[model samples]
Target: MTALTIRPLQPGETDLFLSYPFPRQPELWESQRDYVALLAAKAYRPEHTWVAIRDGVVVARACWWTGPEDKRPYSLDWLEAEPGPGQVELGTALLRKAHETMRNDEGRKPDYHLFLPPGWRDDAMVRVAAEARLQTARNVDLALFVERYSYRWSAEQDGLPDRSDRLEFRPADDAQMLVVLRQVLDGSLDAHDQRSVAEHGLDRAAELQLEGLYWFPSPRDWWQLAYTGSGELVGVIIPARNYDMPTIGYIGVVPSQRGHGYGAELLAEMAWRLNDHAPGEAVGADTDFSNVPMVKAFARTGFRITEEHLVLTDTAAGK
Candidate 1:
């Protein structure tokens, strides 16, 4: 048996990386090509791309990328191994080696993202493949933190529910938004935020939320504070544009006001706002699978589940 060599992609090895005739069964070759092109355009560092070789033949590969306009690496974006008798082992070893090479001095593991079909859990073959991938990730200490269900609502899906006259949405400044965010942080069901609060504490979690919202490309007018007829704050809705399409970035009802049917109303208001802003473009949103209340709210607002994602992170499970 030939020993496997795990190392970073060498300079000018783009052609070599793209030449490996890896099976593209699960992923379209075009999509894979686009990813490689994106990495190249973004000037992805050679150290961030890794490969596994056996008998001088590339067997597996992985890569990472930084956030838009940011230099530090943000996520592990792509990973694949040629299908063969020992593909699983090769893939797992390649991933582990990549993680080791990329970890910060503080021992923080980079977050990795993977999108899977919604039915992967029920189908036996998909389940097996998904599990193998997950197990390989676990070998490098990346564990599944959350499963997010992707939803999108277009004018064609179903007519938006009539706006409730009882609910009024008023533009909120950053200060006001932060106040609302603090309220929603208490006992939040959002898997990402929940984990953030558990591992890093409430203040840090809130800080991250504020930072994300502050950097949102949409105008401040797109953010709103939902209030009842009597002017009591019910929740907040952030309908912002991602790149080009409008998206329901964040919507949450305060813990004290939850379960009073405010979630559906908040979501409906967001959809109405986006439709009025763009008329016909699709509005997208994602919610943690465990967040049943929010999921039902999305359904009520005419949002359909279009995709599912498995979000894996290097953070220790629940701290």
Candidate 2:
């Protein structure tokens, strides 16, 4: 038996990669092809896509990607291996090789995102495959950092809830926004942002959070701060466009102001703001699965779970 050989996809191998059968999902080939092409045309490079071969047969493949303006890879988005004897071992080896090639001495592994359909947990094969993939990445020192339920809201859903109209909603300047972000950082249910605050100080974490929001299509004026009639800070809601659609970029209530049903109010305010900006367009939001309160808040605001995702990152990042 020939030993496995793992390496990145070479130049001019996009066609080969696209043609490879993706384990079990034959119906998704067309969509996957289009996505792979888009990535290649944007941030994809030979070194960012990897494949594992045994006796010259491709057995596993993986790829990393970045946003259009990003200078380096941001995440590992694709990993698939043939399901056969020793499949787990091959998948683990492939992921390990990719991490070694991409990560530096700091052991910074790019975030890995996996989207699964709703109710995947009930399907035995689906659950097993998902667990195997996660464990494979874990073998390479990446851990499951967070799981988020993707939610969507349309104008057809329940109209935005009405709370205290006296609670003023106003556009916040950068300074004020940063202050609010800092105040809510400690008790934030956002696993990624909380982990960022823990690993790097609040300042660095805030910078990263702001960096992510910069991708929104909505302008700065769309970012808002909510306060009381007496000028007390209630919370902040960032309703902006992501990619092409309107989204609740971030919404949080001040730690001292939580538990007063402020979170649902904030989400409602965000939905109203986005509706005003892009009338008749759908709005989207994601909440960590562990954050039951926020999830319920989203539900109360008419956002339904549309999908679920598993996000993995370097284990050290969680420390």
Candidate 3:
């Protein structure tokens, strides 16, 4: 057997990366065809894509995506291998090598995210394909950060949850909203929030969140501060647009405002706002499974789970 070689893709090699025969079992968000379509928009860069070649045939491939305004890759969305033996090891080496090259002296390595169909475990083919890539990440020193549920608000299927009139929403800029964002992090059960606060401190975590929300293509005026009728603070709701659809960029309640059934209401308001802006369009949302309240809020607000996400953060040095 020719020795395996792993490296990032060079210019004009998009087709080469997709040459691997990934079985078309279950439909996923990271479908190769869809990714190829996104390539025209520059959502992916060749330098950030990698493949493991054995005997001149692509056996493994990993694709990373950076935000529209980012210069470097942010997170990996696709990790796949041609169906056959030794594919797991091939995947592990490819990821390990690719991580080091992509980091390029940056302190943080890009994380990996997988969007699998709901109840994917019940399908033997999907189960095997997912586990193979997950095992590769574990082997390369990436830690499984969280399992999150991806939901969609369908106008026809989910209908619309009634918007409560209890809370008053006031338009606020980043400066005013910053304070509330910090307050909500006090006891956040969201896995990403917890990790950010712990590793980067509350101020940084809150700022990072604001940056993320700002990154969306949503309207600035849509950011509103939720308050009680008498002027007490409840939280914030930012109905925004992601790449493919409208979404609730954020719906957060301050620590003091917990347990008031505010989550469901806040979520409902977010959806209504989205509906007002993008009529007849679906709204996407995600919440870590650890965030029971958020999960409940999603369900209560008529958002149905369509996909399960497995998120892994890379802590390994680019050696």
Candidate 4:
């Protein structure tokens, strides 16, 4: 095996390092350069991007960011390495260099995360991660691709039943939207989400621009709350666009209101509203894979699993 020599990418090396992703079809350089430029524009430190250079050729590349504009601590993305005799070793070394650069040297280790595509789960690079002890965090980030959508378009996919005549469904303005957003996230979800919510409330979470990051049509509405004959927040669904598809961003029935099928009804109502208001593509959303109730609720309303995601975490050294 060839020895791996990984280090921080130097200035002016962008063109060369960016071209490494495409051994052939170097035309990809245009798109790749655009992406690198975007990251560089917002990077807290220019050295965040790293490259593994061996024998004067860049073999691996990983983009890194710290305390990016949003509340997100840091992120590493667009990681790719060439298929070479020492690619795995080179990639691991490059990753280690990144960790040390941010966490050790810069003291910026505020729980960074890497979202690896499922196809790379069993790669030698991932094996190095496990040996380094970066514990896999809670919740798989499942997704349903737009292409695999199998649910038939139905008119029944619109509006909630006025069963509990006392409750009303009205489009919410930004001010009225605050109330529904308050209870949007229940801190009881998972270790990761819980920690996040516990530290940063829903308002702060929203400020993270999760919705803005998604491609969705909006003028999002906080569907009127469901109250019984006696007014109370029984159920609520805040629907919006995710990748321009009808996305149920937040739907919850107070624990006291569960088991009476209110959760399912709220989801159904949201689906209908989205179909009616934003009648273009499809409706889709994601919940933790373990959230059987939420998953089942979507399924009952004609949504299906279209993609699987595995969330992996590893130590700085790839343990």
Candidate 5:
């Protein structure tokens, strides 16, 4: 039997980080690289990665990520094992070690999180956590893809059905945009689509679902704002294309504006812009499974659930 050890990655070991390989969904894989690059550019430290090498061969991999200002200390993003005996043990060992080490770090006691295929819901690691009485957080990652569902969209969908009498649409400037975003902060949390920016207390998990949507590297021009004729901002749409494929990112409406059918309008407009700017074979978007209104809104705009994902969080005691 070959022995395995978990340790921090050396500077030159980036090439052996073959958790993402060529033949398997290259675009999304490349997008992960792009996302890592973006985080580095934003000054995110590269931590929470470990490799299990046996006889000079890297047979398993596990990794996590942290957000700005060290919030959400450990977020597990990817985990994989090359086929072989004891692969799961190797991978799971690396995961436990990585979390344990991060918990002991002096800087902060951050939360550890992982996303696994639904089948792993009963994995031993989960059982260990239960036995240890560790805090656990759960959320879903809903998927929309063209492969399994037909889509139909138009500017005149049920949500934004041609309000010819009262409102105008325009690209918002930074100052005006901030005001609109501030209004959205409350609604954002209410919708479970924002991140917890607060520190030093029990952090609300409301924004957990919105993390990916907000993290995307979409330019400002891709965002659109809807306003009343008198200039009262009602809603906003962040129509970002995925780095890997044709897709839309976060879209939100203020609570004060929800019943006006603005949500569907924003989705349709975003789809229209995506169709106009970057035509592709298909488009994709994701939502939290618990977020029924948002999911239903997407479905009304012709999106269907294609895959399911989970965002798991584990809180480690501070050293």
Candidate 6:
């Protein structure tokens, strides 16, 4: 019997971190030079990435990443382990060891978010890779939080979503916006929001969601609160963009107004507004798969399934 060794990469040990003995499916990261650039961009740091080695060979590696302006890691999203005996235990130990240090530094462990292609379970290679990481996460006390369904609309293919006819939208300032943001969380279908509401309460939950929406590059004023013919509030919609693509950032209906197909109305209005800004460009949006109405709304708005994001979170850490 042998024990696997766990440790973080020392500064400038890019190659050593890359020495793990398995090929990544979808293979979306780091050549040595590109990794150097990511370090420079503050997207990744050596000490935040960890690996497990036995007999001088790397068997498992876990990487944490941050937003462009963030100094601390935001998510532990990439993980890999060689397939063999004790592989699961080795990977679990590796993640637990890295998380122990990270939690002490950041006051919490970041969630594990893994992206899978559509119909991933049908693909042998992808399923194995996904399962290995998922099992490791559970072993480390993380739970399967939710599966977010991703939808995209292309002006060139799917065309624009229908403009809202029943609702009039007007921009809300930060203070006024907080009102609707809080109201929408009353009976929210969003798992992240539910968790935030459970742990942080309603006001803080809305504030947290608003805080995340601000991280996008889109103008803050693009957020609009929708109202009916008589000036009654319906919901809120945000047409925004991230570093990657144009997006329908946030769309929520207040608890009192959930049943009138307003979610789809908000989705359509967001698409129209975003298309106006990013003309001829594709737009992306996501909602929890459990939110059936929102999922149907994406279909009604001419969006198609592109990919799904599998979000995993720690029970010990909320949001």
Which predicted model would earn the best TM-score? 3
lDDT by residue for model 2 (1-319), tens: 7898888877778776665564564322222445555565665667787888886677888777755565667777777788766767888988877776576324587878776767778877777777767778887778788899988897757566665576888887777778788887867878877888998888777766776777765798888888888988888888888654798899888888888888888888888778888888889888899998899898787888877888887876423
lDDT of 4 by residue, 170-286 (tens): 555555455554454553343344545666876775444344323334554444566666666676667775432567766666666666767667767776676677665566666
**All candidates: TM-score:** 0.85, 0.86, 0.93, 0.57, 0.59, 0.87
Q: Model 1 over residues 1-319: C-alpha lDDT tens digits?
A: 8898899877778776676676554632223446555665663666677888888788887777654565556677577777655667888888766665576324566777676667767877666656666777887778888888888898766788767778888987777877888889889989888877887787777777988876567787888898888989998888888653789988889887988989988888888888988898898889999999999988887888877777787756322
| Candidate 3 minimal-lDDT segment of 10 residues | 24-33
The predicted structure with the larger TM-score, 4 or 5, is 5
Estimate, for each residue in 67-135, the C-alpha lDDT of model 6 and write its tens digit. 776667888866778776666888888987888676623377887877777788888877876787788
Of the pair 2 and 4, which is ahead by TM-score? 2
Where does candidate 4 clash, by residue pair?
Answer: 129-319, 130-319, 131-319, 132-318, 132-319, 133-319, 134-314, 134-315, 157-272, 158-272
Deviation in Å, model 3, residue 198 alpha carbon: 1.3
Candidate 3 Cα misplacement greater than 4 A, ranges: 104-106, 317-319
The per-model lDDT (C-alpha) reads 0.76, 0.76, 0.83, 0.51, 0.51, 0.80
Candidate 6, run of 10 with poorest lDDT: 27-36
lDDT of 3: 0.83
lDDT of 5 by residue, 1-319 (tens): 8677677576545655644332222212222444356345433234555677777777666555554444444444455554344545565666656655654233433333232223333666544422221221211111111111223343333222232346567987665665565556664532123434343112233234334445655666776787778887777777775444556666668778877766666776777676666654356676665555666777767764544344333333342
TM-score quality measure for candidate 5: 0.59
- In model 2, the runs with Cα more than 4 Å from the true position are 25-33, 40-46, 104-107, 156-164, 215-217, 316-319
lDDT of 3 by residue, 1-319 (tens): 7888888888888788878765654565566347666676667788888889888888888888876667888888877777678878888888878866676225567788889888989988888888877888888877788999999996766888998999999998788888889998879998888888998899999998898787887779989999999999999888889777898788889988999899999999888878888888989999998899999889888899989999987766544
Model 1, C-alpha of 308: deviation from truth (Å): 2.3
